[model samples]
Target chain A: MSRPAPRVVEFFSGPDDLSDQQREILRKMGERFPELTVDELPLDSDKARERGIPLAPGLVIDGVILGVGSVVSAGRIRRYLQPQQE
Target chain B: MTEAPKRIYLDHAATTPALPEVVDAMLPFLREEFANPSSIHAAGRAARQAVNLARSQVAGALGCPPEQIVFTSGGTESNVLALLGAAFAREESGGKGHIVTSAIEHPAVLGACRFLESRGHRVTHVRPNAQVCIEADAIIEAFAADTFLVSLMLVNNEVGTIQPVAEVARAARERGILTHCDGVQAVGKMPVNVESLGVDLLSFTGHKFGGPKGTGALFVREGTELRPIAAGGKQERGLRGGTENVAGIAGFGKACELAARDLEGNIDKVTRLRHRLIKLLDTASPGRLNGDPEQTVPHVANVCLVYVDALLLMLNLSQRGICISVGSACASGKLEPSYVLRAAGMSDFASFTSVRFSIGPSNTEDEVDEVVEQAAEMSALLRKVRTPEEIGQCDENCPCLWEERVA
Candidate 1:
C-alpha cells in the first residue's frame, strides 16, 4: 500500500486568519510534498500549547514543533522533516 | 528560494546605515592600525593621533573644542555618564545635588536619574504639555534651590519634537546650574552648536547619523569638572576610562564631517520627504500625527492609526521588506505601549498603536511612498480582524498574543 501523505500543520497566533506570507510558505511546502495534507492551527490551540510551541507561524510535523516566524523556503522545511522521516 | 527583496530602512532615529566613506575610514583602524592608544610605542602614537583627529572632527561638527568631547560606547553611556558625573561632582563639593529634567527623556537619562535618587540625589521630572514639548519656564520652575544640573533631550526620539534646550540651558546657566542635552537625534540631522544650544554637556552618538555603532561622545564645557565613572588610566581626561574604540571613533568622525558638509541641503531634502509621507498617510488612513509638525525635526513622523494593531502592521510591513519602528519598545521581554505617549497625554489606545517612521538623508521619496502605501494597506486589513483589546476596548494589547507571528 502507498505511504499515507505527510501531514503539515502551520500555526498562527491571536486570530484564525493566516497572513499572506504564512499561506505562501505553506503553499511552497505543499509543492514539494505533492500529496501533503495541510492543517491550520492557532497558536492558542490545545495541540500547539500541549506541544510547548514557543511561537506562532510554527510548523508541526509528526507531533514535534519544528520552526517559527517568517519561514518561506521549502528546502528548509524538507530538512526539518529529515529527522521525522528517519 | 527567491532572493530577498531590497530593504527600505526608515528607522534612522534607532540607527542609520554606516556610510561607505565612514566604513573605509574605520577599516584601516580595525585591521593594520590596531594598537592600544595609551601605549608609549610608535603604533600607540598613531592610534592616539587617529583618536585625537576623530575628537576634533566630532568637536567641529558640534562647534566645540576637541578637548571637551569624551568618547563613550554610545548614547546611553554618554547620557548616564553626564547625569551621574554631574550629580557626583556636585556632591564631592560638599553640596547635596538635585536635577531637573523632562518626563519624555530616553530611559538612559531616566535610569541615571533613578540611580542618583538611590544615591540620595533629588530629581524632578517635569511633564510636557499637550504639544509634547517641555516649556522653558516650566523646566526652570521645577528647579529646586539645590538643583545643580538640568538634563533634557534635544529631540523626543519617538515624537520628534525639538525641545527648547537652548532657552532652558541659558536660563539654567544664569542660575548657575549646569545643563546636559541629549543630542542623539539632533546633532547630525540638524545644526547643533554647543554655543547655540548653551548646554554645558551634550550627548550624541555616531550610529544615528550614518556612522558605526558602539561610538558616542559627551561634551563637557571647559572647566566643568566631572567625576570619572570608571577607574582606569587617565583616558577621556579622567571622565571616562578604558581603551578607546579606535575603529568606531574613526568611522564616527568621518560621518560627522560628512554630515556637516551640507547640513541645510540634507535638512531640506528630508523635510520634503516627511511632508510627502504625512500627506500620503493622511489620505490613506484615518489617524492623527503624534508630534508637533511645526516644532519637530522633519525626519521622524509618529502616527497613530485608528483601530489598527501596530505589531501586526509591523509584521506585515516586514514581509514586504519595509523597516519601521514602533513608538513602543519591548521592555523586559514583553513589548509595552509607549510610556512617552502616555506622558505626553495620549490615550492608552493611541499610545499602543502609534508607529514611528524616522527618515534618513539617504531615503528617497519613492521609497517613502512605497513604505507608507504598504503600511496603510496592511493596517486596513489588520483592523478588520483585530481583537477588541487591540482597538482600545480593553486595558492594553497583550503584545505576546502576536509577538512571534511574523508575516
Candidate 2:
C-alpha cells in the first residue's frame, strides 16, 4: 500500500530561532519521512496569523499545532503521528 | 570513517578559547585554593590575596588605582552599574539627570539606558556619521543642561570602529558631565589606558581578552561615586555586592598580563591579516564593506553582500568549518536587523545582508585566504540561485562606491 500524503509543516520566523539540536532532528525527520513538506512563513505573514501559529518556531502535524516555542524531538513527533502512520 | 574537519575560528568577537596561561592561572583557584575571599580563615586570606593581586594586575593594565576596579559578573553588569549608578547619584543630588549615548552601543549599555528611561530618566541617542564613527561633535550637540552622563563605546562590537572616547570625555568634562566608556572590545585588542581615555567610568570583560567568562571590571575614577545597584555584602568596595568568581578573576588577571605583553605584536599581526582579508573580499566579489576601514580596529571586517542572505552565508561558513557571527552575538538569533548597522545608516535590507568577520590572534594568514575563497564561492552560488527580485542594489553612498565604480 502507498503511504499517505505528507501533512507536517513547521512555521519558523528564521533558521536562527531553531537550535542546532532541533535542526538535526528535522534533518533526521526529512530522511525518515521524505513526504514531509517544510514551509517558510514570514513572521509578519497573514497566513501565519490566520493559522493561529506563533511568530516563533511552531510545528504542525495534520494542520494542528503539535509543538510551539520549543524544540520537539523526532521521537515525540513520531508518537504524535502514530495514529496517522498506522 | 572520515576525520572531523579542523575548524577555523574567525568569531573572536563572540568569545575566545581560554588561553593556556589563563587556564593554568585559574586551575589553582578552582582546585586546591578554593575559598571564599570574604571569609576570615587562612584559606580565605589566601583567596583574598589572590583577588587583591588580580585587582592590581587589572589596574596595571588600565592605568588606574587597584581600589577603583569593581569586579562584576561581566560586561552587562558593569555597564548597568555605570549607567544606573551614575544616574541615581545624579538624581540624589536633586536633578533629573539625562544620558547621552550612541545608537551603536552594545545591548548591555543600550538596554541599561532603556531601563533608566523607563524609570523617567531622559536619554538622547547620538547617530554615527557616514564613516560609522559617533562624532564627538554630535554627542556634544545632544548634551542637555541636565545631561549627567555620556556613555560611549571605545570599540563598536560589530564594526570595531574605535570611538573618540578621549575627545568626547574632554568635551563632557568641560560641561561637568560624567563620561563612561564600554571598552569590552578595545581593551585587549588595542592599547587601552583608562587614564589616557579620561573617562569617569570604564567597563572591560574577561572573555573578550582570553579570560574566563563571568569575569569583568568597572573602573570608577577616584571621587567618582555611584550608588550600588547590587547591594548586599561589602564586596567590590560596596559598589558591586557579591562574592566574586575567584577563579575567573584570577584568569582575568593572567589574561590582562598576557594581553598587555602582546598588545603591540597582536595589533601589527591582526592589522596585516585584516587588510589582506578585506582586499581578498574586494577582488573576489562585489560587496559593500561596512564602516571606515581606516578608522576601525584591525580585527573586524563587516561586509554586506547583495543577493546573499546573511543567515545562509553564516550557515555555509559554519558547515565549511569557518566560524563567524552576524552583528553582535548578544543580539544574534533575532529577526530584527542589527540596530548598530542600521544606526550607521544602512537600510533594513542592507542591514539584513551584512555579516561580521572578527579576526583574532589565533587566526592565521592561510586561514584568512581560505575564508576569502570560500566566501567568494558561496556568494556566487547564492546569487545564482536567488531570484532577481530577491537581489537588490545597495544605497548609493555605500562604502563600496569606489569598488562599484571600478567594477
The lDDT of each candidate is 0.81, 0.81
Q: At residue A79, what lDDT does model 1 achieve?
A: 56
Q: Compared with the true structure, what per-residue lDDT tens digits does model 2 show for residues B1-407? A: 85646899988887888999999999999999999999999999999999999999999889888999999888989999999999889888856778999999988999999999988899999999866899989999999988889999999988889899999999999999999999999988998998888999999899987999999999999998699997888998889888889999999999998999999998999899988998999889777788887788888898877666565576567656788777623233345677887787776667766888989998899999999998888777555544325434556654335434435
Over A1-69, each residue of candidate 2 has an lDDT whose tens digit, in order, gives 887687667555545546445567777887778877767566457765645444355555555444333
lDDT string, candidate 1, B214-233, tens digits = 99999999988688788686
**Weakest ten-residue segment in model 1 chain B by summed lDDT:** B398-407
Scored by lDDT, model 2 comes in at 0.81
Per-residue error for B265 in candidate 1, Å, reads 1.9
Error of 1 at B1 (Å): 1.2
Off by over 4 Å in 2: A1-86, B328-334, B395-407
Task: Give residue B155's lDDT in candidate 1 (0 to 100).
Answer: 95
Q: Candidate 1 regions off by >4 Å?
A: A1-86, B332-334, B387-390, B393-407
Ten consecutive residues with minimal summed lDDT in candidate 2 chain B?
A: B327-336
Model 2: lDDT of residue B140: 93
